[model samples]
Structures are given as structure tokens and as C-alpha cells.
Target: MYKSQRELKKDAVRAFLKDCKEGRFDGAYVFSGEEDYLKEHYFGLFKKYFLGPGDDQFALTVFDDMSFVLEDFLDELDNVSFAMSNRILLLKDVDTRKLKGEPRKQLLDALAAVPQGTAVVFYYDSAYLAGDDAARRARQSEITALGKSARLLEFSRQDARELVGWIRRHFEAEGKRIDDQTANYLILVTDADMVALNNEIEKLALYVEGPDVSREDIDEVASRSTGVNIFEITDCILSRNYDRTLRLLTACRLNREEPTVILYHIGVMFSELLYVALAAARGITSVDTVAADFGVKANRKFILRRYFNAVSTLNVDFLKQCIGLISEADRNLKKSRLNKWTELEMLIARMISAQIRK
Candidate 1:
């Protein structure tokens, strides 16, 4: 089977940790990627392994925010500190590739000749090396150059399997239990980032009355992403709960979610629901079979099930009308200066009305 980038990175991170635990040290390392939480996490472990307890200022040097000087870095690297046996120099947000000609050569040469018991870490914080197309190409070029001299590790978001396991463990640590399915559902509704998920897990642990976490508990307590809010709004519409639907739409506005973004999700929801409706008509009702037909990821099969729950109440004709309404709203949102919430409210009314007439 083909492995994903995230899976490769996850395996690399595991190997890196194992090496650290076994006292294996690299001369210089580059930490780069979108997973800020894990990057910061492993950096803590890096310090723990390299500097140990009660780290001294003399043992560690941090150069950040354009404060790095080549001479100063070389001096620090060669200082041979008596305060500690393992010394580390951290270069945060420093683009070493900017050093041209001799300076760049010297930097590489310094890395090559890094003294025993000393280590250097070049950390590219999230989004630091990314922007436009040119910037991204430049970042890649820099990473390629640096990779030749340092151990390069990219930290990105974990796959759904890892995230699901993490959620289950967090609940377990809180003296509560959550099954794989419910934990995965939490990930679906909430932000998948570790920081946000951690906070949500804490909230759920404290708010739940029983030992086992349920989907109901998650729906009641977990923070909803814009996607989740729109899902709820669609569900309410299917149930003919107009008041609750309008309330959720207003809540989306209050949360500062853009109407265009909200409309885009609404369109997607209808499209998926239409697919479910068609599948039901064909007597293909299994969530897995429908999800596979639609190319939905394994982690998101719950979404298909949700749509299936509401599909029995609707038919293809009404779903097609809803999509047409969304397209019209999209045009209005682009062409006019109408009160955005008013436009969405009107769109909701029309969609609900379409269901009523159907």
C-alpha cells in the first residue's frame, strides 16, 4: 500500500523520538512544517534530552527575529562551555539560505565541523517560510540546500487514525472512556488541530456526567467548526425545525463566518444529500458503499451516515432545487451589496420552503 506524507512524517517523528530516548544525537537538525503543536512538543523533548534538568543559559543560545550573526553563532558553537556537557544553539526563524557565497559556505562548513557534545537546531515555525508561490519555491529551495547539511524533519498534521487514537487516550486519561467512533465524531465536529482538540477534550471530560462519552455529549459540548454548524443547520432544515435552523444561521453570522464560505458548505451538503437520496433510490443504503462511491475519506464516513439519516425524508427533485437556490445565492453574494445575513436568511427561507412544497 502507498503511504501518505503524513504517515511518512509520523513514522519519521517516531524514529526521531526513539533515537532521542536512546541518546542518539545528530550534529544539526532542521524542524519544519505545518504541525506547530507537534513541532513545539518535540522541541521540548529535544531540550529535555539535550539539556537535561536545570538547563543553564550558558548551555543554550537562541537567535531569533534577525538577531542571528554568523560570527556570533560560530563563537557560540565553538565556545566549549564548562557549564554543561551537552550545549545547543537554536536558530528560530532564521533563513540561513539568505547567506550568499562565502557566508553560506561558512555556515555549511560550521555545521560540518560542529564540535562534539554540541548540537544546532534550525526551527522554521508554522507559516514562517510560506506565503506566495515565489516564497514557497524559495522555501523549498532553502530546505533542499539545508537538507544536505542537517537532518530535515517535517511535522505535519497526523492522519485520522492517529488523531482518533489520541482522542481516545485523552478521554481515558481523564478517567472516562470513549469508543473509536465517538472520538472520530468529535474530530469531525471540532477543529482537528491538537491545541483545539486538547481544549475540547478537557471540556468534555469535565462536562460529562457518566464515564463513557457519547455522540450526544459531543454534540452538546464540543466546539463546532463552521462546517459542523452548517451541518446542523442542514439537519434542522431536514427536520423542518425552522426556528432552530434560523438560529444556527444567525449563530454562523455572529461567529464571523463569511456568507460565501457558509454558502459553499451549504451547496456541498445538498450535493452530498442528493447523492445519498439517489443511492437510497437504487437500494444502496450502506454508508460504506455510498461513501466509497462518493470518494469520501474513511475518517468522514460518519458524514455519509448523517446525510443518510435525513435522506429518507427527501427526494432528488427537492435536492436539485436546493442546489439551484444555492447557485442563485452565490450570484447575489458576488454581484450585490445586500445585507449579507439578510441574503442568507432569505436563502434559508427559500430552501426550507422548497422542502415544504416537496
Candidate 2:
């Protein structure tokens, strides 16, 4: 059956798991995507499946394609497995866009003629194909040719619901419980990177020493990702919570977040708020429309609603003034000799004071 790229991506994990269960070993495979955790996890599974309980050093071959010679890779693939029925060859960081002319043709030809007992896997850690359109097209053509004789799997970011389920299972495996609300809170406070989330979960499980992990536990222990802290600062500003705003800003600085980065995020939040405010004035209250107009993801609709409500009482002139203040602070951070911290603190103070006066 023919499937679109989107469909293939959507079912990539499920298909791989099916192949794993059925013991289907294709001669060649391609693993590319943004989700490093999933890619690495599946790679481990493949290793176990192919190598079994034997010493992997004899059966497994890994190469960093950046420095790897194509001829050497082909030589290794042609060699029979010493300790297993099949040899597993892993090529990491295979940036196809960089491969051109004779080397490219030789690699593609070698992939097409992979030995019967050899399983070759190309792993790309990047989220997207790099280079100009021509280079990208050439890489896509190579991938398409490989797809005819292999499995091309792409791992994308999991949405909120998928993340929630993953969090639940992670806690359950440790004989601990995390309620949905608490799980959602954890997701909000952290960047939705599974690797980071897993680390936090491990830390929380070890610290709680209880059957249930609570929201308070997460608040006390989980490191707030930079993006989350930035959002919190903006939320505080929108709600007119000056004390909380300052505390969040302090937390950001303590975490070693750069002053300019903080200012940049503040600027973005105000700009978004200004757009929402203008949209509301035109009587556009539909979440879908607002999301489409402002590029907000579905999972973040609730946060957008908060922004919409907060901005309802704010006028355009005030929003403009806030943006102006942020811009000035940004320039000062880059050009002025003043202490960056002091300049940032003054910027936040001025924004808060302006909001209070409004």
C-alpha cells in the first residue's frame, strides 16, 4: 500500500515495533528525526534483537559517517559476522546532503547491494534535512531509492496526550503514581523533551519515596526549562503579579539564563499579547482562529486563553509602550556598559509600573 510521508511518520514507531515482534530484519534501514530518545531506544532494541546475548563487540560495527570512508564501510559490510548470524552496521550523522559525485554514487550502490547477512542502519540525529533546495532534493532522491529496499523511519515530537501517557507509565514502572493534572503540570514546566522529562521523573521518584508524586514535589525538584521560566515570567507580568514576576526573573538569572535571552523572550511574549489583544477587539474569540492567526499549537490553547483574557483589559497603546521598553532594554544589554542584571531588573520594574498605572 502507498502511504504519504506524513502517514509514514505517524506510523513509523508502530511499524518498527511490529517488525521487531515479527523478527523481520530488512537488509537496510534509515532512522532520522528530532526525537533522539525514541531513536536511541529503538536502536538499542535493534541491537538486542540482532546480537542476542552474545558479545556485541564482534557482531556490531559503528561509524561516524562524518569521518567514515565509504570504501571502508563497504569493506566492513562485506565481512561475515564472527559471533552472530547477521552483522549490524550503524552509520551515525550520515548527512546525505554533503555526499556528492563518485562517493555518493558508491555509497548508494553499496546500500542497494547490502550482503544477505548484513543489516545496515543510517542514523541522522538532526530534525530536518540541511542545505539548499538542490542539495535537499538530491538527498531526498537518495532516501527514496533506499526506501525501495529498506525501512525509512522518522521519529517526530510527541504531542501533549502522548507525553502524558508516557509520564504515567514511567511512574507506574517504579511503583509510583502521578495524577494526570500533576503530569500535565510537569510537562508545562519542562520543555517536552523526553530525555529531560525522563531525568526529572527519575529524580522525582528517588526523592519522593512515596507511592504518589505530587505537584508540590515537581515544583520543589524539577528544573524549570528556560522556555517554561520565560513563559512564567510573562504570565506573572500579564496578571500584574509584580512580586512573582521579580522572583521568576531572579530564578531565570540564577539558572544562568542570559540577560539578552530573557529580554528577547519578554519581547516575544508582549508582541504575542499585543496580537491577541487586537484580535479580541475585533470580536474574534474562537480558539481555532486565534491559534491559526498566531500559530499557537492545540496543546497550548489553554495558555493562549489566559493570554487572551489578560490582554482583554489592556489597550494597544500600553502594549506598544511595553514593547518599546523591552526594545530599549535589549539595546542597553548589547550596547551600554551598565550591569546587565541591573538593566534587566530596571526593565521589568518599568514594565510592571507601566501596567500598574494603566
* Model 2 spans with C-alpha error above 4 angstroms: 1-8, 80-84, 126-150, 240-247, 259-302, 305-309, 314-358
The lDDT of model 1 is 0.83
The per-candidate count of clashes, in order, stands at 0, 0
lDDT of 2 at 192: 73
Q: In order, what lDDT does every prediction score?
A: 0.83, 0.79
C-alpha TM-score for every candidate? 0.69, 0.77
Tens-place lDDT digits, model 2, residues 63-156 = 8856787778877877753334778888776655566888878877887777777888988774445555686677667666666657888776
Model 1, TM vs. native? 0.69
Clashing pairs in 1: none
- The TM-score of candidate 2 is 0.77
Root-mean-square deviation of Cα positions for candidate 1 versus the true structure, in angstroms: 5.2
Candidate that scores best on TM-score:
2
